[model samples]
Target chain A: MSETWKAFKPYALITPQTLVFLLFLVFPIVMIGVVSFWEFNGYSMTPAFTLANYQGIFTDVTLKTYLNTFKFLGLVWVATLLIGYPVAYFLAFHVPKLEWQILLFLVCTIPFWTSNIIRMISWVPLLGREGLVNQILMGIGLTQQPLEFLLYSDFAVVLGMVHLYIIFMIAPIFNSLMRIERSLITAAEDLGASGVQIFKEVILPLSAPGIAIGSIFIVTLVMGEFVTVRLMGGGQSASVGKLIQTQIGSLQYPLAAANAIVLLAVTMLIIVSILRVLDIRKEL
Target chain B: MQKRALSFYLLLAFFCLFVLFLYGPMITIFMLSLQGPDGALTFPMRGLSFYWLGQVFQEQRVGNFIEPFVRSLLLGATVMAITITASVLASMGFRQRFKGSTVIFYMTIASLIVPSILVSLGIGVVFQVMGWPTNWFSSGLGAHLTWTLPIAFLIMLGIFNRFDPSYEEAARDLGATDPKTFWEIVLPLIAPSLLGVGLLTFTLSYDEFTRTSLVSGQNNTLPLEIFGMTTNVTSPALYALGTLTTIFSASLILIAYFAYTAVVKRQRGKA
Candidate 1:
């Protein structure tokens, strides 16, 4: 009895979490894969094996949407990295004390915890035609008319994504930066390396895992984004996520599932490529 | 001691502008929510009052939000309970490599990586085909657990990876039983991480959108309700609702932080 009990302990302890995972995560994904092969009519679906849904993905519009979504992903990744890196650098190296570094880091991340929809909508008051940015632009004689691209355009979509997703960049980069030995940086400087050279040769290479982590986040999010494109693009943009959502809305479950599988494939392809460079488990 | 470089000042200015850039739009919306009865969505302040904020509570004007808000809070609490219990157990069980440990770890990571829409659609289809009435509590709850549980599990894993096991060994050496050792040594040591897991699960559940929109069945969560209001409702009342929900999330964060610090201080006192 004691031997059997010892053997069963870990599995028994993990039962609840494993159950939730199988029921919610693994089962649902498997069902999606199953449903992707089923046939769906206007009102309901049948369990007939059909390749019709997968064949639908070759349309020009779907290809265009995949291209558009990838474009947003690249744009947001570059913007978040360019803008968020310096902020992380400021926190990791320049901050004089640990407590202040932590406090300010919390300041950076606190907004991320709040409602994302609220954060997305918050842009409207400032980016709309009669909003503050336009008012200031007109006041300074930058332009006589409000920039139509400020809100409800691809510009707005990119801006909102950068705003929302930049947190993912800053947090991990800061984490990776915090783990770097200060002595290494000091040694580089003492060896007559310029600040730029020290950063280029030492800091940048070490932060690769962080950059990879942040890139995965930004890419996956922007690629699968429907809500951000919907709210910020204001229906002016097309995205893979939004296309899938539209399919589901029109009672096209099999088609949506097919798109989701392709989406999962593309996303996993990018992420696996990133993972080939770094072991995320080892980083944490 | 050396004179601070010009770079420091320049970086400080940039940081200030970034902070302003982060917060200015939010503040604009919050202030606009307080605009008088006739204020437009844009600026040129139409005088300040609580009229628009009050208008959010009037369901006849803005579809029912109070129920959704309250429902979201309840759902958050429910998810938090399960997440804390399950994540704690799983993390404990993970302290030793067992059968299927690798599978569970990958599944947890996969749970995080899978697109939210896939979860929403998958469960929605499963429940519909099962002849079950998908609900805010059933399928909705399951969808949310997939999002929150992996996060909580990962956090707990981080905490456990850094955990000092010497204390537990010492307790056991002192003739303490397994349950006693766990309760006396492990739980207190990990209380702060548990608090973090709690806060994360609750807030993520409360603010969830893409996953819940399709699976939440007939009713809406707070985020879904706010999303619906975005399209047609062009008033500061929407901003008022935003302000309220943001305040709710912020206060929860503040409360969690305070509790965390208190636990840390108490642990220090004991040590």
Candidate 2:
């Protein structure tokens, strides 16, 4: 091959992938950004640029929606970490056999492939007024009446989000934990390090990349979440994603696009900060 | 030293509970799916029968489930093929240090983290502006590709990192043409990763809901159909659909696992 052809060969090979990426990914994002500044009439959106959509988002309702989303994000993050860290640690460190470790790891991942909507709705029978939990509580004389607050509340929303996303935390943390060299821990032990000291000094720092990656997944998913909030919170809560969806439903494309752009910006900021803290590129 | 520590036991207990937490709802839904004709959506089963499973086929309450199920299957297969082909070519290009590669790589990653709803809205609006109707094979396939291709690219990056280039060079030196070398030597060696990618992209496309919601147009995919049913359909039949979809996905995972193990064993034997 000639030098020019050789130089062009790589570009030629990458053309199809690049085309798809540009047309679908980059173009849509650009479109959303452009649409965000346009004017929205009651019926249709016009091409005139305006800041009204952005101004509209600076309201008490939008503020409450954001506050509610952040509240859920904090709760879900802590819950998934508490549950995911121990499980990942156990699998990586305590499991004695390789086959058993793989088996259990696969078991944890199987639920991830199923439908998220189905899994979210499955909580209804367990947490509803006439559900199993209420029945068990009443049967055990734990309460005088069924707990109406068990389902269709903030508690239910957090439970659903944590359940759905805990595996995302476990997978990354377990991967990073497994990558840690056994010799490091052995060296710490030989130097008279206690269990807590070894974990705090050696294990925690090594797992920072995994935790950061997992936090990115959980936080972004919770921030842009609509279905879970609507289904579990039963319209009692509003999220930025839910607000955007409502705008889209009403054909208020400019406002929806503006809300979406803001959500994307906030999500990207959180992810970029996490990336800055730890270079996940090396881990990947 | 061989004796287990107290912390090990506590951690083991925690592991088991986490497993239960992950699988408990699924198992409960599967059991509820097996309820008899008189059974409600929740517990206290009337009796065990496959009546609800039968109801899923006959009932039109949740829209036409069969049509959407078929559409999802076809779309998944198409997305899987495109992802594998595009990712392989892209990974090969990545082997050479070229200008603009870093920009493309970051773009793929950006596609991965962008909210699915935003993509759907943007695509829907674009199609409307262009006077083109969104359809499953066109708009829906594009939406699914935006989600699946990024993941496929990441997996391909890992696959190519471990792949040696000397094998292909040897084939070329033996008088094999470029196409012939790629087809005979490069492909067979990387077949295992391709299969794994195929299975992953297929499952992702099949179970994709949020991205396909607005852009899927009038034709509903399985996930879309199931989402529609969640609000109104209150019977064991809904559980039956869940159980069925879970079974389909689990079977795909098992097949992929066996194929992967077999490939590894054969490679080890040759080595």
Fraction of the native A-B contacts that model 2 recovers: 0.63
Candidate 1 CAPRI assessment class: medium
Residue-level lDDT tens digits of model 2 in A150-219: 7889998899999988988998999999999999999999999888998999999999899998998897
Complex DockQ, candidate 2: 0.73
Fnat of all models, as shown: 0.65, 0.63
B16-82: candidate 2 lDDT, tens digit per residue: 8888888888888888899988888888777999988888788476576888889999999999999
Who wins the TM-score comparison? Answer: 2
Error of 1 at B271 (Å): 2.3
The whole-model C-alpha lDDT of candidate 2 against the native structure comes to 0.87
DockQ of all models, two decimals each: 0.73, 0.73
TM-score of each: 0.96, 0.97
lDDT, candidate 2, at A43: 89
Runs with alpha carbons beyond 4 Å of true place in candidate 1: A1-3, A278-281, B1-4
